[model samples]
Target: MSRQSIVTAGVLDAALVLLFAAIGRLSHGETLAGLGVTAWPFLGGLIIGWLLLRAWRHPLSVVWTGLGIWIATVAGGLLLRLAGGQGVQLSFAIVTTIVLGIFLLGWRAIAALVRRTSRKRMPAPV
Candidate 1:
């Protein structure tokens, strides 16, 4: 619920979307100049995801925020792309889901693991 956590979650999720686009562009030998085209649709979905799920409350929670964003992004992005006459192949959907799942949820999973480890190492409270 803190301001910093909300900001961090937003930044992390947005950066993952950008990273997904940038890395895909690199893999396809496309220039980064086209990142806007690649990133905007997903970013749009990210906005919707946040709004629909009230993700700001727990934006880094894997089950709620992360999964919600992934599903919303894929569905929203496909709709946007379809409206724009852009390609929305099945393969793209599958790839987007897998990659976004990793990027969005992966960090939180790692953080949770680390927190668990740290807690185990701490002495019992007096």
Candidate 2:
């Protein structure tokens, strides 16, 4: 809702993306350069997740945002594969995307819960 929230989400999303890519590369015995290719899906996930959250009005919107972004990333990778390319690594990419999405969205959810609890603890204006 606020600009700060949006910015925070973006930063978290990007960091998760990088983290996921690094882990993926390490797992596959590949170099960190794999991070470059992973960035596309990461960026896509970030944008999509942020936008969806921005428009979200329900308490569970964060969960939907995370799942949606994970789906989007996987779908993007699948499209790339279908387009006659070497394609992104399916296992690593999808797993990493899901994990990162959860982390990012989970952070938002926790923050929202904290804010809500705090508001409830405060006295209402007369």
Candidate 3:
């Protein structure tokens, strides 16, 4: 993959985490003052996953990087929230896992499909 694509993958992952945090905060009627706090757990988890995977080199790998980010984000987010005295509801956990999986994995899946289709459409060189 090109350097630009790798960077874009990382940015997309971060953006999705931020989006998830923002939506959750809004849903809970949280004031904007606490937005940073609300976003940090998941973000922290994402960072850890990136580090563990050394993801900067290959951020677009759906199996390694994407799955690692998803698992780390959810597990780390839950653990951190619990440590911070934020109760984790079964329903909330379920929603977070489902939504993050969709957001984190969805883009990569779409990109892969597009690349596959485009490759098929290209004519072979003589």
Candidate 4:
């Protein structure tokens, strides 16, 4: 992939992580301060998103990408729980993964739609 595409993917991943954190905090009736300290969750989301993008043949395949990300995030969380001394909050991790997947995949879907529309609008060579 081109450097620009890589940068865009990173931006999308970061946005998804932020969105997941925001939603999690709101749902739990917690403050942003609490989220700030728990950076692992968001980092996990970022890693999952990046992996999904890397695994997919095309960035436009949002559904598959999202599914991949969801699977990876949950599995990663579980592994982390098993490997780490502390217990992992399964529910919280699952919810965060789902939210992050949706945001990242949703952006990809929108980008695909925009590209398709633009292609259709372009003038053909005479």
TM-score, every prediction? 0.92, 0.66, 0.89, 0.68
Q: What TM-score, to 2 decimals, does candidate 2 have?
A: 0.66
lDDT value, residue 123 of candidate 3: 98
Per-residue CA lDDT of candidate 2, range 1-126, in tens?
Answer: 666665566666667667766776787799886577756655664566456555343323566665665565556544543463545566755575567667656776787798899999999999
**Scored by CA lDDT, what does every candidate get?**
0.86, 0.62, 0.86, 0.62
Model 3, runs deviating above 4 Å: none
Q: All candidates: CA RMSD in angstroms?
A: 1.3, 3.7, 1.5, 3.4
Cα lDDT, model 3, residue 71: 93
List, residue by residue over 23-107, the lDDT tens digit for candidate 3.
9888889866787787788888888888888888767767877888889989988888888888899999999999999998888
Rank the models by TM-score, top first.
1, 3, 4, 2
Quote model 3's TM-score. 0.89
Q: What is the lDDT of residue 90 in candidate 4?
A: 65
Per-residue lDDT for 1-126 in model 1, tens only?
789989988888889899998998899999999999988888898888889999988876888777888889878877877887789888888898889888878987886788789999999999
User: lDDT of candidate 1?
Assistant: 0.86
Candidate 1 positional error at 86, Å = 1.1
Best by TM-score: 1
Give the count of colliding residue pairs in each prediction.
0, 0, 0, 0
Worst 10-residue lDDT window for candidate 2 reads 52-61
